[model samples]
Target: MTGALAVAEKVPEPLSKAKTNIVFATIVLGMLLAALDQTIVSTALPTIVADLGEAGRMAWVVTAYLLAEAVATALAGKLGDLFGRKLIFQLSALIFIVGSMIAGLANGMTLLIIARGIQGFGAGGLMVTAMALIADTIPLRQRGKYQGALGAVFGVTTVIGPTLGGLFTDHASWRWCFYVNVPVAVIMIAMAARTIPRMRAVVKPIIDYAGIGLVAAGVSCLILGLEWGGQEYPWGSPMIIGLFAAAVVLLATFVAVELQAREPMLPMGLFRSRVFTVCSILSFIVGFAMLGSMTYLPAYLQYVNGVSATVSGVRTLPLVVGLFVTSIISGQVVGQTGRYKYFPIVGTLVMALGLYLMSTMGRTTSVWLESLYMLVLGLGLGLTMQVLTIVVQNTVPYAQLGTATSGVAFFRTVGSAFGTAIFGTLYTDQIGPNLTDALMQVRVVSPEVAANPQSLRALPTEVSAPIIDAYADSIDHVFLWVVPVALAGFVVAWFLKEVPLRDSARAGATDVGEGFSMPEPSDRLVYLERAVSDTMRKARAEGPVAPRILADAGSDLSRGEAWALGQVYLHTRIRGAATLDAIAEVHKLPDEVIEPIYDRVIGRGFLTEDAGGLRLTDTGRAEVDRIRASWQRWLGARLDDWDCSDPADRALLDQALANIAAKILDEQAREQEVAHV
Candidate 1:
């Protein structure tokens, strides 16, 4: 953390400005690849099913990717910390490239679903590691601007993904959607290899293997039960019931495991906070409403309204724009005033109203009406989704911040998966009966044409009427069923506690990018570093930092002595010895400029000079340690208001601050990374 560190820490010299730009660009590309893939398949699904011919299994394309991505995101950060962020990032990109190739070539639904799952796993790593790498590489003072830019990428790409997918499906082929990531990923990998520096965690990261496994397995089982119910099996069939039972048992076990786990993947204690608990539920509902609508709207437009894939995507813009605009507005308003209890309360109610309105659509519903319905749903979701993480950040203990933020994201992703699965089950169950009944009444309409929307659309208006009506009814029912879920969220939102926002959290309240939440974990040390940076940013706004810091330290040294001592200590670690000439050369100065400082340092008995250049005396090393301790004390005073009263939590916060202090003091003092090659 920083108090003096704001003006005190040197710019880590490993990266020049050019190198930082190249590294940031590469990270943005990889993150884009991961985020873009999430919604890219939505508009393409109808076309993909037309080619692959397993319409019933269509939702699996979306669900498989989501579940796989969830697991990968949960584990990727720890994996990066344990190994190295750069290597893991490259590996993730490679995995994604390979998965894309397989999906592009797959000849059957089973193979395609498997390939999509692989792609999702890689995408997860790309997203989480890319975010972590920013922490590794970016300077503290500039991290927020960079992080906000990355968040904006998610929002912008989200708005475009469905439309881009539709264009590819219509112009080239549905497979091109997967094929496109390959070349982009290759370029990202190549640039990253040359430009990004290698970095690893300062300490071993804890991975909750059992918790991750149990939750993944349990969620998968639950998804399968919902997906298969009423289609391949009856709701009460042995197989469906078994899946549900296994899900409940596994999830319960996962909860038990997390409760006992040291540094649990999701600390059970976070749910004890009313804000965190309520926000998590609201996040799940927003995800359910948002994704469920995004995934199915294309079907209604393409099948019932007889629009092409590209046009269907274009029509969905209202929803995306509504979401984007409202999220920005809500984030800005909430940031200005620390009050946010009513956003979710109002949001859920609006979401329920929107879904109910959409559920009333028939085959003849006007395009304008459809767009308005979509817009309402989007606005509701946007308002609700953006604030949940911020609220959790404001209320959770400093030690639990990382897990709580990620925990809310986790619930959102899982909710999206569940929503798609449930919506698919509802559609599959209803569509068959409605189609079968229509086939009897309209014998001239063949089953084959009915299965393909493109073929059915070419038929005479009279012949296609009944079939289109059937598709509309099925989609309408899916929305009708989900309205209750949104209403449930409305009931839950009433329980949200409006905690006053922390000053650090309040600083970014107006950031539009903050509304675009992704399932990425925060590093506790990195977050603490940002918090201190915020303090310094405000301090810099007020006046000078160094004088205040010096007054606080009350040490018997001038700024030059401290700067000289720090450089000498750092030089000895890097270059084996710090000669006056080498120090002068490194700073691009003459010996005349450095000689006097060296003589003063030598005269004080803090440095020893000989043929070995210069080395810190034991006394000098202690002085360096003293500066570090001062930094720690300054950091502690600033964080006194942090809610970590439990002795264990307080200890963790202190340890995190100490680590931050050491990092600030040392900056980038890595031994040469031969492994990077």
Candidate 2:
């Protein structure tokens, strides 16, 4: 049959506001749970190591999750396609709860690290599936707005995580760090089951199993080496040497696998685009700066400032405020004007300045001074972080869109892993020697008391003075070393050529989520729809694409006439009937608003309202098909550049185009204006 709504099979029927809210709530919760975990363990890490007695390996508490989450993110999209988005989403939540319980129950560092990994794996699934679910179920007209809100959750979580973690650690126990996820996730799961549609992806995304394993092992080896070197073992030790060697070999192998894989997770081809290349580099450093700082800043607060976990979390607010303020502002500015090349350059440079300022913090630094420094760093991060994803999306080919977007995120996560490990290494290497010298002046400082920030703070001022200085100096050491990394990003940012952002970005498509750098999965079709919508809206290409082709197709119908026919056709095709009432309900407008359109179509003999329901006449059906074919030709003309050498690839691309053509409903006004109401 010549389908009128073939493109809409991928998108579920539009939901009522109540239903949308329910679905949106579930998506936001899933995303919050995942993104929150990325940094939530920060404030709790100090107390966890004190309780577990593996101070040297504390970084793994955060690193294990990041590394595992990175690996899981690579697979989540494909996995969702293979099974079902809702199923994968629920399973991911279950896995996360299980990991959380295990982490909370664990008595040793080894078991805790493994549990965190389990949690990270689950978190990754939650993050990616949440994004895919949005594309799968939400109406295309409203998708960008929701995506942006989800991104805001990520930015808010960066601040919330540390504070919430600290609250649990100070008032309750460090184990509650992971335990907290259980209740929230349980609620999300229940809500998801009820609200999220159970639909499987028609297109089977190629899963790079070997590539996932290779990258997982490679990144793991690399992170483990960074975390372990000069702390658990000497940098030159056989174990450390082997880890780095394995990392090099495995990563090199992973790159080789990507080059050959049918659908590589991080396509080697993406680097050819100057924007992708520079954005990837800057993204890594952004994650490095953001996550790395959040992970350890609590330790500096607790030990150096003699603040409790909860207080330390609050103290970090200046940084969060800076991040939120700039992140939002940058997004708006970029949306108004398509220019964005200057953000990364200025942002990275400011980040370096922030890091340099932070390096000067010591035992004598006041809380207010520390906050100012943190705010500066946050401003720098806010400026640099949000623009990369937007620019890269605009720059990369539509075919490689999904891969490139995910690639930017992958680099950022990996960068976070590296940053945390390096931070831990610097702090660990410095603290021991620095403390040994400082403690030499004190007669008897208990090792246990010295390690526990709370216990050490209980000591007399003079007695705790040396330990505080040691802690302060150690943190300062990390900030000082990391300044160079931020500077490198600044250097790379200069090479990032400004690609004009699509109208979608100007329409606020990427404002919330992309700016804050959410761990979003790639869905090229969804993105393309938004971009096209934005372009049309910006150019005043109002109404439907069908009218533009009607002139060429020689259709007699007016723009509203085409829209009326298209809507009735889609409605009848999907629900087996179309009615004025049904159209009003679906669009959430009144009968009066919809009756005018239906009156014209029925009067024109295109549609008939019978006892059974609304039916499209033969003429109406033919016009719809002709309009669809014209759209197909239009798409084909623009998409011929895609390398579809393989018949299977060609079929997939053709089908996608056809669906897109059909999906472009001959509607009235704009989806944005209607959907918003």
What local distance difference test score does each model get? 0.81, 0.80
Query: Which clashing pairs does model 1 show?
Result: none
Candidate 2 clashes between residue pairs 3 or more apart in a chain or in different chains? 151-513
Q: Give Cα distance to truth, residue 176, candidate 2, Å.
A: 2.0
lDDT of 2 by residue, 248-343 (tens): 999999899989987777888887878788888898999899889988899999999989999888888888899888887888888878788888
RMSD for each of the candidates: 4.8, 4.1
Error of 2 at 307 (Å): 0.9
For model 1, the superposed segments whose C-alpha errors exceed 4 Å read: 1-13, 555-561, 569-634, 662-677
Worst 10 residues of 2 by lDDT: 1-10
- For candidate 2, the lDDT comes to 0.80
Q: What TM-score would every model get versus the actual structure?
A: 0.91, 0.89
Which lDDT value does model 2 have at 336? 78
Would you give me the overall lDDT of model 1?
0.81
Winning candidate number (TM-score)? 1
Off by over 4 Å in 2: 1-8, 536-564, 571-618, 629-658, 664-677
